[model samples]
Target: MRLSEYQVRFRTRDLLAISGPDDFILGEGRAVDSSRMFEPDVSPYCFDLANRSLVCVSTADISGATFFYQAQRQYARTVIKVPFESLPDGPASPALIFSIGRCGSTLLVRTLEAAGMRAVSEPDFYRQAACHRPLDISL
Candidate 1:
């Protein structure tokens, strides 16, 4: 759902508990809610491997036309930290798209989405992984 469609209120402690350890937590998170962590719109915005934690923020409605970083910062109030070990095992095989700059990759992704395929455009997690060379986790 689009972030604007719903009021983004800070969840209450009881609600957080009911949402489960993998869904919500009080204050800064020590572990990520695995379900929300994997959503298409949730981007792993920061990583602190030494601390074994990463921060995720929602990016709903972000598209090729949007300024990614600017929009992310505005929508970052819901950010939460997740420990490395809390991350679930990835799919045995995952599909990916790669292209050089100005190659219409974004257009291709948009087209695919129009055809009912789920795709994320230049996700921050991918960029983070690329910049943070020699990552312990396999890409």
Candidate 2:
């Protein structure tokens, strides 16, 4: 899909769109997730102002866009699945809110999300990282 001008602007301001090591894991199809590999250096979410959605584009793509280099996403690119072991540990959150059931934690997260912060509510990665284990497809 051709990126809109607004999307370009959003990407320009995205803190996570930086060139570095392989911090992403390509899934079965077109899905990909940031492993928080470059923790504390960059965030994992790209705040899309136009769509109000969080999107993750490859760092190479961001580089291309920044430097005016032409590299199409649909071209013959190496899509690699970064191993879980390669992912670096995420940084400790500066602020964490704990609560019982039906608490406002979700609201807080959503509010942060709306303000262009990379906030997640009860992310599965927390459990996976806590156990120091990768995900099992069978489970």
Candidate 3:
């Protein structure tokens, strides 16, 4: 199937970039506006309740959009409600490291990688969500 000119130009950016929760406002199932970017989207990637992981999918095809790797820490925070906790019942002692910005976190990660330890970094979904929502409005 071929895309129309309007559709081709209509950029499909992430929900955060284009719209907010109120954009999906409805009265008796009638949409107030067709142009608003956000609707009550039920994307699996947005929130995985079962796995307790919020996945942000940013496409590379869009120009000037925030890339996942660039805002790794912020994106990590957006996906959750509670402060991150360690897995209590795990067999091994998980190496949890924290540092201020510009410190050697990257170097530490690299060193761990060199030592053959699998290192998982920034899951900042909460921060990303803050950036997405309208600051003036209340949730």
The TM-score leader among the candidates is 1
TM-score, every prediction? 0.61, 0.31, 0.32
lDDT string for model 1 (35-137, tens) is 7676767766556555666666665666553335445544545665566777777789989888776888778878988999876665555565556655555
Clashing pairs in 2: none
Error of 3 at 75 (Å): 14
What's the CA error at residue 96 for candidate 2, in Å? Answer: 4.0
Ranking by lDDT: 1, 2, 3
Off by over 4 Å in 3: 1-89, 125-139
Instruction: Rank candidates, TM-score, best first.
Output: 1, 3, 2
Q: What is the lDDT of residue 48 in candidate 3?
A: 24
Error of 3 at 138 (Å): 25
Error of 1 at 3 (Å): 20
